[model samples]
Target: MFEACLDRGLTLKKVLDALKDLISEACSNVNSAGISLQSMNPSHVSLVQLNLRSDGFKIYRCDRNLAIGVNVASLYKIVRCAGNEDTVTLCVRDKADCLFLTFETESEYKVSDYVMKLMDLDVEQLCIPERDYSCVVRMPSKEFARICRHMTQIGDAVMITCVEGGVSFSASGKLGTGNIKLSQNSSVHEDEAVIVEINKPVQLIFALHYLNVFTRATPLSKTVWLSMSADIPLVVEYNIKDMGHIKYFLPPKIDEDSS
Candidate 1:
């Protein structure tokens, strides 16, 4: 048996909305530690990882480890029926083939329950090696999303250059070329500041299309962390407040110009 309750139904809805575009279905592993999911997009060009700590939930319990396969899009539809302020609980019984969802209002005046069939998905766990990144940038999530949106409009690819105290995003296409630079802001609150830490300068090119997809997670957090290194995947991470974090790994485009 496994059950976890979130304080707000909207939180779960936001998570599903952010993932439905890239992954239609995936398995969520629940254990004593919490729940986690790691899946690659159908195109296999990028990977997404999510970790939700058990303590972060309003109430959580696990009798044993369980891997629950879910159709993300379908579940999102059902979750949307719940009110934003309602409490959301996900429950699974032993030897059951379906997952249960319950939504309740604070005043106990309203309650809703839904059951979704589980799937048997064969998903392998990948071993991600630990490595240090040459450049790490912490900036506002909204700003990153805006940059991705603007760059994608200008070109199919974006060249990211991280220098000492600033980072620049540039794109070139038939229409024209555009570049936007952001300098470190130390006066602002840490969450809103644009902070850059670099061991050495690095310039890399990535597909703006996938970067734009990653931006769908912007609503999950106020700040985003970008980690990049030569010949390695770019790590875009958004911490879910006290819950956990969701990270997207996208490899850089090699031997190609921004256009």
Candidate 2:
């Protein structure tokens, strides 16, 4: 059996909402540590990973490890029915085909339980090794989202260049060219700070459409980290408050003209 309760149901709702655009169904692994899910888009152009630590929950228990498959859209719908302040609890029997959800009002007045059928999604966990990136840029989540949104309006792709003390985003299309640069800001609050660390100058181009999708998680965190390296994928990570984090991996685009 596995059960976990969250003080705020809205947090779970937002997490699911952030993943709605990328994957439809996925398998969430429940263990003693917590719950985690990882899946790639249909085109495999992008991958998203979610982690929710056990210590962050109000109540958490896991007799044994279990893989719970679920439809992302369906779960989001059920969570949406919960009030913003309602407490949500997830329940699963030892070998049940359906996952149970309980929502309780803060005043301890109303309680609701929902049952959602689980699926048998063939999701294989990939081994992602940790390595140091050549450049890592930390900036406000809203700022990154806004830049991604605007860049898509001007071009299909955006080139990100990391220099000594700053990072730049540039896009070019038939409409025109647009460039935005941000230097390390030390005066602002840590959450709103823009800090760039680079071992060596590196520049890479990426599809703006996918980047815009990644910004869906902007609401989950105030700060976003961009980790990049030459001939490697860019890691966009958003720290989810007291819980864990959600990360998106997108590979750089190859310049066909240079080929």
Clash number by candidate, in order: 0, 0
For residues 94-182, could you state the per-residue lDDT of candidate 1 as single tens digits? 98599999999999899999999999999998988988899999999999999999988789999999999999999999999999999
TM-score to native of every candidate shown: 0.98, 0.98
Model 2 alpha-carbon miss at residue 106, Å: 0.3
RMSD of 1: 1.4
* Maximum-TM-score candidate: 2
Tens-place lDDT digits, model 2, residues 23-81: 88989999999999999988998999999999999999999999999989899999999
Name the weakest run of 10 consecutive residues (lDDT summed) in model 1. 250-259
- Global lDDT for candidate 1? 0.93
